[model samples]
Target chain A: MSEKYCIGADVGGTTIKLAVISTEGEIVKKWEIPTDTSERGKHITRDINITIDNTLEELNLHKSSILGIGAGAPGFVDSSTGYINEAINIGWKHFDFGVELKQLTGLNVWVDNDANLAALGENWLGAGRGVKNLIAVTLGTGVGGGIIANGEILNGANGTAGEIGHVTVKTTGGAPCNCGRSGCLETETSATAIVRKAKEAIVKEPHSALSSIKEITAKDVFVTAKQGDIAAQQILSDVTETLGLALANLTVAVNPNKIVLGGGVSQAGDQLLQPLKDAYSKHCLPRAAEACVFELAELGNDAGVIGGASLVKQYSNEQ
Target chain B: MSEKYCIGADVGGTTIKLAVISTEGEIVKKWEIPTDTSERGKHITRDINITIDNTLEELNLHKSSILGIGAGAPGFVDSSTGYINEAINIGWKHFDFGVELKQLTGLNVWVDNDANLAALGENWLGAGRGVKNLIAVTLGTGVGGGIIANGEILNGANGTAGEIGHVTVKTTGGAPCNCGRSGCLETETSATAIVRKAKEAIVKEPHSALSSIKEITAKDVFVTAKQGDIAAQQILSDVTETLGLALANLTVAVNPNKIVLGGGVSQAGDQLLQPLKDAYSKHCLPRAAEACVFELAELGNDAGVIGGASLVKQYSNEQ
Candidate 1:
């Protein structure tokens, strides 16, 4: 008898990553496919189906050996009903992705918010391993967060428990956010926000080295700041400061055992971590601040796929 | 054998309320005693000891039949350790209220924040009885909150999980708070803030009826506003608006089944609830806003004692 494996799929705007993992969380096979989110919601489902079929064939895994499929997508998901209420980036509104996938592949499917999957992934096998209470933050295009408490995802009544990106960070409203709110934490600390602020700084200080770059990203700002570019350094400092303040507020509210930092901007490593820690310490209530440990995410980009697989396994075991 | 009952003690700065409740959550007996919080920390122990003795005698119950005692106080409490860490209101730091009480009465004692106790009380026997996930807001001199999830109180890593009073409601700093932070949610939406705003409004509108009063309380402002005083009404509106916005942000994060309002100012009832619901609907994500139900707290003053009793029963059962 062949070993049973579960398929985990992470669907994003530009690509989808899929992985096949055994019951013990070991990856047996993995692959990726281009995501056609340009055509709205139609192509995403089609793309996922084709990718799954190809991966199973390559792995020579029979349908009987495949336990189930798990998918993590960006947006508000009704995990209980397997429905996506809205994904502004993907232009999907109330799409029943789970039902559609189940129909196309004849497999049981479990779906949830991508950030939440990443948090679970980290908790099960990555940085948050051995910790029952944790919060994972992804400082990507937008600030995303996932919370795990008492060994379970903190999915609030509407499955929006870990929407840390939308929490208010600035007491006075600053720039507007994509979520139709102003002064959201994402407006100041996300990778996109960091770049936006850097651009503004370069425009104001044309003599700086950062102004010479064709286009500046969060990475560019961090690299230049490290080499002593005063303007870029200031931008990096401000971003971390804002992030720290938000984390401090989060510490008081969630009181997690650990906070894992992931996403593209977190790749800057210590350049970001040290400053963020200082800010968190300065702002958090003394005891909670001391109790929380901040660390870099170990799963990196694979967190979504691993988390998706874990979700499927968890769902099946419960049933 | 006679059914066992839990004892609840609410230790406030000026008063203490005690109640004996059956396991089924019925209040079998209750009483009140004056608390000399002004006499430093020692008087608190004396007051509690005297109250418990008198109450047990009055109810004709022996100490052997009492299950345990749960205490609620204003401070940072290590619920597991039963230690009160720095309660500025009572001018005590690192006070072992639980150990002392247990030694004096020869009964187990549990201690937690007063607001959290009220929330637990409501969850067990009041407005939030059937809801597993909810947030209880106490709008008094200070804004305090308690979160109940999955039929248990959410005491985060350092036991500070439900401090919604400190959640940032204003993106731009509002007013200075006693917590050493500016623009905290409590600074803008607390009963004290409402009264301060009312006084400011009276200054701006010299002819307003509220201006005639030398000193103003949240209740006084509500009454004058109910009589159609423009300044008082405007201040009250601002208070509700801030509260609604705060609730909207909190709903996004907690996705609670309901938000129960308590404390002194909550007595305003519909005058506060209507506008708060409207503002919350306008500001919250549509799905989260629709899922949350807002209501006035049902436990009233008994919430403290009842919640305290519930805590003891629940904790002991878990152990």
Candidate 2:
């Protein structure tokens, strides 16, 4: 008997990462291709099909050897119906990615919000492996979250259960968000916000090393703050405090056993986690604060791919 | 075969309501007793036992007909361990209400948060009936919440899943809350907050009729506002807006099929709901907002008792 395999794909704005994993979660082959999501929905679908076909061929596996295919995309998805309701960045609306992909490759296809897939991946084999209840927050260009309860993803009534970034953390409506909402958690703590706020601060404190840079990023702020740049440090502190406030609110509301932090900003590690933990404990209800455990995500960038692979297993079980 | 019955109790800070319910969801008989939770642990047990005995006697039923009993209390409860972790108002900590009640009455007992029980009751027989995914918010002295997903109460890993009152809607930390947190949803929209904010406004706007009142309550604020008191109306608008913001956050995060509003403040009806719906729609992602439906709770005060009675049936099926 030969090993069974499934194809996992993570489609992003600029590129698509594809991986073939064995039944035991081992990646047998991996590849990537530039995604032309801007051209048309058909072009994007064709690109995905080519990647899957090439990956399987390189691994000496036929299309028949694949069990199913799972893909994670950024947008509102009807996982049950396999429809992409709307993906603003990709310029797609109500696109049946699953049906089109299945017809293109003659394979079963499953699609969901990328953050949820990442959470599933982490829960199955990463930081949240042993936890029965967990919430994963990703701090990239924008903040995103996925919730797992009793070992299952909570998709809620409309497959939007874990849209945590849109949660309001500010009453003053301090910042504008792309989601057309004011004072969202994402507006305060996302990497984009951190960089934006840092650049704005540099104008006032021209003595800071950050002022020398043409453009500042969250990474620049982290490095400059570590070197004792007061402006950089202040911005970092603000970001962490904002994140902590959101964490406290989430801690009280969800009361998950573990909270796993992921995405680029999370790479700052303890610089982000320590202050966040302090603020979370200070603001949360005593019992809930005591019951929660916070940790850095272990899966790193590969979480999305691994999570996409895990979706095949999850969907199979559901069926 | 003999008819099966269960005893359901709703233990509030001021009163304990008890009912003998048949398996078919009928309240055969019910009674109420003053709760002396002031004395803490032992007194609560004695009071609960006496209430159960009296209710059973009034219904002309014997202990042999009782299948089990369930109680809902205002506190952080460890439903699995049958412990009331904390009841701030009652000063009860780490009290095993279920164990004591079972020992005294010789019946299997289950215990949980009162608000959660109310949600369960609503799901079983009230406005939320037939909806597998729903959240119920009760706006009384303090705001409370219950979450039901796929027909089961969402008691998070630590048995604190549905504490929606603590979800921060305001980033500025508007007012201090009883839970030692700031800017909690309860601090702005609860019945207590409605009255407190109204009294402050009445003092400033001395020309208003509300200024002549010796004391203001949530009911008084709603009534005075309806009668065209500027101070009262302003407070009502603030309360409705705050509640709407909280509901918008919840709707985005959970994407429940329906949100049922209950408790004293909800009695303001469309005066509160229309503004809340507008704010919620404005804040939520279009997809999630479109999928959600808001309604007033149908169970009223007896929702707790009915929900507590249904717990036996709910858990029995789980086992």
Listed in order, the DockQ scores are 0.44, 0.55
Instruction: Estimate, for each residue in B17-45, the C-alpha lDDT of model 2 and write its tens digit.
Output: 88888888887887788878666646977
CA lDDT of every candidate: 0.84, 0.82
RMSD of each: 3.8, 2.9
Candidate 1 positional error at A156, Å: 1.1
Give a tens-digit lDDT track for model 1, residues B117-219.
Answer: 9999998899988687799999888988888766678778767888878865454557887767667778888888988887788778989888888778888
Against the true structure, candidate 1 has what lDDT? 0.84
Query: Per-residue lDDT of A72-129 in model 2, one digit per residue for the tens?
Result: 8888888877899877777678789989999999998988888998898788779988
Clash list (residue pairs), candidate 2: A170-B171, A171-B171
Native contacts retained, all candidates in order: 0.52, 0.58
In candidate 2, which residue ranges exceed 4 Å CA deviation?
A1-6, A46-67, A103-106, A170-175, B1-6, B20-24, B33-67, B88-91, B103-107, B169-174
> Candidate 1 residues A1-319, lDDT tens each?
6688888899887778899999888999877887777767687887788888887888788878888888989999988777998887777888999999989998889999999999988987899886777989999999898887666777788778788888765546577888776777788888888888888988899888888787778888898888899998888878887788777776766678999999999999998999999977776666677789988999988999999998888788887
